[model samples]
Target chain A: MSSRLLSRAPQDTPGTWKSYLGLGVILLVSAFPVYWMFVIATSSDEAVMSSPPALIPGDQLMVNLREVFTMQDVFFTASLINSLIVSLAVTASTLFFCSLAGFAFAKLRFKGHNVLMFIVILTLTVPNQLGVVALFIVMGELGWNGTLLAVIAPGLVTAFGVFYMRQFIGHAIPDELVEAARIDGALTMRIYWTVVVPAIRPALAVLGLLTFVATWNDFQWPLITLNGTDYPTSMVALSDLASGNYVVYRRVLAGAFVATVPLVVLLLVGGRQLVRGIMEGALK
Target chain B: MALTDVRHARTEEPRHAPPKRQRFWLHRFDTKTFPYLMIAPFFLLFAVFGLFPLIFNAVVSLRHWHLIDKEKNGWVGLDNFTKLASDTDFWDALVNTFGIFVLSTVPQLLLALMIANLLNRKLRGATFWRIGILLPYVTPVAASSLVFAVFFSRDNGLANWFLSLVGFGQEQPLDWRAGTWSSWIAIAVMVNWKWIGYNALLYLSAMQAIPKDVYEAAAVDGAGPWRQLWQITVPMIQPVVLFTVILSTIGGLQLFTEPMLFDENPAQANGGYDHQWRTIAQLIYRVGWSDLNLGYAAAMSWALFLIILVVAGINALVTRRLGGGK
Candidate 1:
């Protein structure tokens, strides 16, 4: 399929030029808002509000950064740490639990397996937002309201992750290997840890990266669960900064830029893998 | 059949072999326990966080309780739900939510499909274009909404500047945050900008999954690219199209941050300019956090959940019919 796609590359001709032009226009329209973000981020506040509006970069970026730090104290450093810890914790825990369950559902002989799998799939449509009000009360009762754990706790056992990993492992891992390991007297956990894990490494990598990115970008749950008193994730901090009544536009932009840089870097570094994962997700 | 055979073999030799039977039972126990052990964490976590909260929220919805006045809590039965049913603000917010959902999701999906088709063509710099499109999806929502706020400002903003360039210069800049329709438009634009690319990329992936032989065969039959796209690619990716539609309905209905932040008065939980942009999620937050009416907020959340469930169900039914009744 890929080879055919590659071989069908249109030669440079008037027809090809017309296709390219059409695509170029589409790309420009799709990408303009993001470009305008960086443009305004670098422009002065006055220039941003000018009659014509600044299309060119201004020289107030440093000043804006300074103001953002002084005014919001977004605790940019702390927020970054908080985001990192929460995302990593969610990713690691999800990978561990999801893969274990996925392996069991795929390779193990267990009673009620079909029923359990059905239940997991059924929960997929139940959006997490439905439980937020109750979740808040639970957190309040547990005295975990202001902690990063509150944000990470509900996300750790995503039904999507388990279902996705099950499909991946079922398709990617061979039944013969598990049978061979069993015949060789390898324990179930040992076989899973050593054999299944290595075989499904690619799927695990995709799921892990996706979980990290989603957790990092999450807003609603964190907004409800994490009070601003202590550990503020970057999204929460950015929301507070933007909503501040006395906020300066440029500094807010700077803070926005600061918040966005890590994601950009991650995407650039893992673009191929991320794209492949998203594609696979959509296809499924 | 295999289980019966194994059971018959086990029972046949069990009269004089208690130790062997004990070992067999232990092996069976190990086999059964392994899967349970492996899958326990998810059930455990869900019980604590997902299931318990859901049931508790139902209970909370039955009471008349404010967060600040815990001792004054009283059994309200169905009063909160009845009150919300009659509330004008809730109805207005519900209307605005659906309005924005239609305005944003329909165009966003269409544009996404078109762009995906464009990207699917044999072109240079396809990788760059694909990554560039994903930029908006990855950008922080708060940041993107703030950027939109600046760009859509009534005075001295880029959108107004462009409008002026097109001979609306003498008129006043459009007050995007003022009335219901204008606020909905701004909210739609923000949503469309953020999500269109993500959907486009999703469509692109689905397009890529189509076997090239089908398209080639269509081409051989004298079909143009446009005709081939409609007759082949669209039908093949219909499942993906359904997926995106349902997913967007879910996300779009719960939208809060962009409108909440873009409201003229950010500090106020009430969406600005006569509550023009108030969405159900925002209203839930306002009732719970701002107004301190926890019971009412819980009821609103459940109401919103029911709305999502119904919308999602309708979407599923429509998509199933559209997907050739599969």
Candidate 2:
């Protein structure tokens, strides 16, 4: 047994070496673009456009930031405020509505309950892009053409959110507890507020994180609806900055980095829950 | 206990007035009402935003009208549909959309599966590795696509630098935003880079759920890792593979942001040079926003919607067959 154990150690070392080498390769490939973004962000326009590119950080980050801020009213402050307000409003509304619907679907018995659930699930198959043109007209008609409401209104009740919450509530809350509250003559809203809310706290946290990240990172609809006239999301502003003819590489990179930071931080904080939520939502 | 008591009283004391009275009060009272009330906001919001807009879109698609002249939106029975059927530009956009979808999605899923398999092995700092893989997916689309646009630029681009090293340098940096195939390749790379990790993570999660004993038994039977993977892992995760494939197809058909951003140059508004990269979504945007042909844009949207539904349906059927399940 001792001889076998000694032999295994020699064999295992090469395998371990290979595994570490593979891991190193993956880490480099995955991180290089992000590293490159920062490197460019700090470099001057000339350094960025230089022949071999600046592999290291340069001294123009602050200057580039100043340019980005002064170049447009859309970038540094207004867009940031717009993004924050839209994301916060959307997240809060989604949480309130989705949890309520989720609770009903999970625990409540009502007329057309099964049918309603099926319809909700069916909507998942319809891509929101399909309704873009008509929705644009609707927005125009409603006088929400350049407002943040145009961006936030359509995304308020995500079908995925409802589905996710229902699954979470089904497993996390018990019917017996709710029934007990009901027997004591608690109002329907009272039981939900006092009992069900406490039980599903973790699910709410997960949903909130997911919803916030999604709203924060959303691009296409905002691109269409908010056209950078009155207020634009961070993404739309960044797109305009990059797409313009007077290409200042450092400022563009700076904008990109700023846009990416919030999402990276959020993902780091909620990575595990996010992964578990996605897996549960997809597989189940 | 209370529910059971209420049920017992209702059944046993139907003829007795006192028990009936108590049971009636119990039956009418409960907290279920609250759950329903709490849940109403989602339905209310969905009715206004989700369902109404969808129904309204379908209605608008059938009418002949411009946004500026709403009074002219008279009911035109299937005229929009018929016009789309005969429009060559519509067909071209449809072809371009599917072309790019196939070019990107096929290789993306294949590469993702391979990467997920590699990552599934026992490795050091597995959490770090997993997060690194997902970095691209999490990067904001606008920002990453901008980076890609710069990378694919004609002059002094990194892609050309590497290509020249590999002996493909004789041609001018391939005019990525210009020709049909070049623009498609650029779009495909952006789509693949952004999504491959997402699909990989999904595949990895499914793979982890697979039992270890099956792989152990295969190894005991003198099977190599590749053979075990092919025989055991692939079959076990076939359902997930189908799911991603269908999801990717739906996503691919929509193909808006990359093409829109990549073709942002005013000169290339008709897609790249000769309208090579113009997709259905771009066409819809161009008609509605740029040209102010809202009626034509609505028509195009309906046409694209039908195409998406059909493609998704076909994808579902094919995957189900390949998955070998009822």
Candidate 3:
């Protein structure tokens, strides 16, 4: 037992130098495109068209960023703000609604909990592409097409979020504690506010971060609903820059880099939680 | 026991202050209705956006609901499906979808498995390595596709320059967007680049949960690391592998954004001049929005959903059998 304990240290593990080399290569391959994007973003227009392409960054990043903002056709700043609003709104509501439902499903013994949870699990398999046509029509009927409402409404609550929270709440919080709160005469809403919310904060942050990124990066639906609108999401605006007739690689990449930086930074901050969230969902 | 009694009495004072009758009513309401209210929003929103659209699609698919045609919104039962049966464009899209699915998913899963195996080993700066690989996954699809488009462009592309440096296809750099196989490869790179690290991390975490003594025992025996990975880690993480397989199948079949933006004119919804890599989702978007044939698009949507269900089922079945056989 003593030997086993001693052997469990990081220095005693069996990783070879070969593994480090392989991971180094993986890291390089993984990071190259984003690095290339920055390189292009900072390069002159002539450098973009150079025979080998620009392998190094220049001093033109500010110029290109300025160009992306002042470009005539795309509303870059407005779309960035639009993306922020839609992402935050969706993330907030998804966290609240999913957690509320998840708490009830986990702790509160209701008549139809099992059946409702089964429905939620089943809904996970239905691809979003299945109902795009009909959804477009429905949005049009509600006069929400070409508006952020059309983009935001369908994503207010997700089946996966509810399931994720339910699983987390079931496992993370003890039934005895909940029963103790009940015995102390704490009402359900009050208990959830004070007890459940605080305990499940890590899960909430993970879900919120993921939802924000997914909503921010959403391209297809927004393209379908808000393509021609003056106020588009950042993704839609990037697409506008990309698909233009006069293809300027520098401008397009600068816009893409700008759109991607916030997400990359968010991931850098909350990557461990994100990893925990994904693995927890898949393992059990 | 006296200490517990005193603490309980002190805590119970607040509840006793609310008269017994009111407390009883409050508890009943909390138990009965609060659960329903908590779960109501999900059901309500899903009905409006999710289930209703599905049923609505079934209804719309049977009618002639072209926005431009003079015979607008006519009930033409089964005609749209029959016409779709002979639609060459839909078949081409289907082939391209499966082609890219195979091309991307197979390599992505294998590479992810290998990377996860590498990451499973104890290493220095572990979080840095993890976040490094996962960086691509967070980049927006629109942005990544645009970046890759430049990378794989025929003229002045780093891909071609690298290929030239390696002395393969030295004379003629591949026009990645022009050729069918070339376009599929380019788009597959975009898809695989985004997903490989994410899937790797999932596999890595599952690997971490496995008992370390298992590997130690294998090493004590005659097993090499390669044999141990195949015989142990792969089998141990079979369920996670299955989960990822099903997920990739669904996401792969419904591939959009990458192929859509791969086209120079994304709004055109033409995957290419000859429709080289147009997925079913792109085709649906084109038919419904571009052509204004809501009925036909609805029919295609239903067909694509069924295809996804079938493909995912097959993938799950095959994954299970592979694990069992091994």
Q: Given the true complex, what DockQ would model 3 score?
A: 0.59
Chain A TM-scores, all candidates? 0.88, 0.90, 0.94
Instruction: By TM-score, rank the candidates, best first.
Output: 3, 1, 2
* After superposition, candidate 2 runs with Cα above 4 Å error: A1-20, A73-75, B1-33, B69-73, B216-221, B264-269
Which regions of candidate 3 are displaced past 4 Å?
A: A1-12, B1-8, B11-19, B216-221
Q: What's the true lDDT of residue A102 in model 1?
A: 91
Superposition error at B101 for model 3 (Å): 0.6
DockQ of each: 0.43, 0.38, 0.59
Candidate number with greatest lDDT: 3
Q: Per-residue lDDT of B1-326 in model 1, one digit per residue for the tens?
A: 67556443233442544587676675676687878988888888877898888788889999987888788798989999999989998999999899999999999999898878877766777777777777777777877888887777788878878888988844777877776888888889999988888898898888888876676666555655566667677788888888899899999999988887786456566777688788989988888877888899899888988898899889878877766645
Question: Which candidate achieves the best TM-score against the true structure?
Answer: 3
Q: Write the per-residue lDDT of candidate 1 for residues A213-267, one digit (tens) a residue.
A: 7888888778776645657888777777776556666766777787788878877
- Cα-based lDDT at residue B38, candidate 2: 62
Off by over 4 Å in 1: A1-15, A72-74, B1-30, B211-223, B320-326
| Model with the higher DockQ, candidate 1 or 2 | 1
Residue range B199-318, candidate 2, lDDT tens digits: 887888888888765565555456555665666777788889888988998889878778876754532246765778888888888877777666678778777777877887888788
Worst 10 residues of 3 chain B by lDDT: B7-16
Please, what are the lDDT tens digits per residue for candidate 3 over residues B181-243?
A: 999999999999999999998898788887877766665455656676787788888989999
